[model samples]
Target: MFKDRTEAGRLLAERLKKYRNDPGIVLAVPRGGVPLAYFVAKELGYPIELILTKKIGHPTNKEYAIGAANLSDYFIIHPGAVSEDYIQQELFVIRTRLKEMYKKFMGNKTPENIAGKTVIIIDDGMATGNTMLGTLNLIRQGQPGKIIIGVPVSSKEAVEMLSKEVNEVVVLLSPEAFYGVGAFYEDFKQISDEEVIFYLSQLQKPS
Candidate 1:
């Protein structure tokens, strides 16, 4: 288990050393992945961007992700799992949340373009990988030159599922007995909006 997200990020950065100073953008899953992406972007001297995708959950079981969507696009990962009305409602709610989060995280700065650029998607960890898959699908719309998955830890199934969809996968650990993402981290605290803003501010300062 990692001491914390910072340590996990540092170790993950070492594995991604080859990409240092390359033409790429790191798109981190917000809140949890921001801290980890900060380290990778800082290490590689690349800019860090946020991939704002929210899961469209099932009507009966909120925990069950039927699909995922961003501002411009939405995908129903599980066919006929959720109704059109549910998806529409969730999409509207998610868009509102995404706007608030984007404003809080980056203020007026527009998101970086991914076309013709190597895209590194970073997250603290993954369990089912559905959310990340949704993010990837959205990113695909941008037609990135390459897509890479970077995570500190993930389940075996998640790794396999992601490996086929992306150009490369860099995961620190993928244990067979994986219970949850937090189980692999010693100090997996809930990341706050202020913390996310702080990291973004630090990264944008003139070097």
Candidate 2:
């Protein structure tokens, strides 16, 4: 098991040393991804950005994600019978909250240009990877030079699924016996929004 997110980020950075000084940007899936992506951006001397994507839960079952929204645009609905009205309401609420979050997390900073630049999307880990996939769909529309997925650990099934969508997948561990993302980390505490702000404050702008 890894010590924490920082340690995992350092280890992942070692493998990604080749990308240092390259025209690549690190996009992190906040709240948990901020710390890990902080280390990567520091190591690679790249600017860090946030991918503000969230899963849209079903009306009947809040835990069940019927779809996901990316940066207040682009919604990917699951291939199932979900009420259009429910989806619309969820989209409006989710997008409104996301804009608030983006303002809090980013301040006045605009999103980095992904067009023609290598984009390395990082997270602490992935469970179902639905959130990441949703973010990927948004990223693809920007026409980046390449899209890479980076995570400390993930389920074997998630890795296989993500590999097909992204140009490259960089994972430290992909164990078949995965129960959940937190199971692989020794100190998998819930990341606070304040902690996310702290990490974002520490990011160095690309030179």
Candidate 3:
């Protein structure tokens, strides 16, 4: 496992320095993504901001993501995991929770203004690929000139799936025996909504 998220980000940023002066923006999938994106943004000289989205949890187990939501008021439900009837039944609840989470986690951030820009979506890592997929659908709405998915590490399947979703996918590792995203990181603390907002508000302050 990597020493920590920062170290992993440093390694990933090296691979992304080609975009240092290129026309691009970094959209982080918080709250874990915030840290990784922060370091990468600093390295590559790009603006970083949170891309708001939420997991559409299973009807019975909220921990399990059946799909996810995008900022355009759209949800990406996993076609293989749940039936159409089941997803249709839970659509309303999913949308409601997603909006609530957007407000709670994203604060006053606006996801617009990315029209025709090259947007790079950053996450600490990917496990199921649902989160990255959901966030990608949202980013695609802005009609970016280019779209890239950057992660420190990911499962082989996640990397493969994400590769098809964006113009470019940059991952440090695609371990075959990956059990989860945290498996690749030594420090995998649970990031809270408050922590996400705090980092944004604190780091953005004028020096």
Candidate 3 or 2, higher lDDT: 2
RMSD to the hidden true structure, all candidates:
1.0, 1.9, 2.9
| Per-residue lDDT of candidate 2, residues 71-176 (tens digit) | 5466655655677777788888888988999898888887888899889999999888877777788788889998989999998888888899988889999887
Candidate 3 lDDT trough over 10 residues, lowest sum: 69-78
Following a full C-alpha superposition, what root-mean-square deviation does model 3 have from the true structure?
2.9
Local distance difference test, each candidate? 0.88, 0.84, 0.76
The CA lDDT at 47 in model 2 is 85
Per-residue accuracy of model 1 over 51-170 as CA lDDT, tens digit each: 888888888987777778888889888777667787889999999999888887878998888888889999999999988887788889999898989999999999999999999899
- Report the error of model 1 at residue 1, Å: 0.9
The list of candidate 2 runs beyond 4 A from truth reads 205-207
TM-score head-to-head 1 vs 3, winner: 1
List the candidate 1 regions with Cα displacement exceeding 4 Å: none
Better of 1 and 2 by lDDT: 1
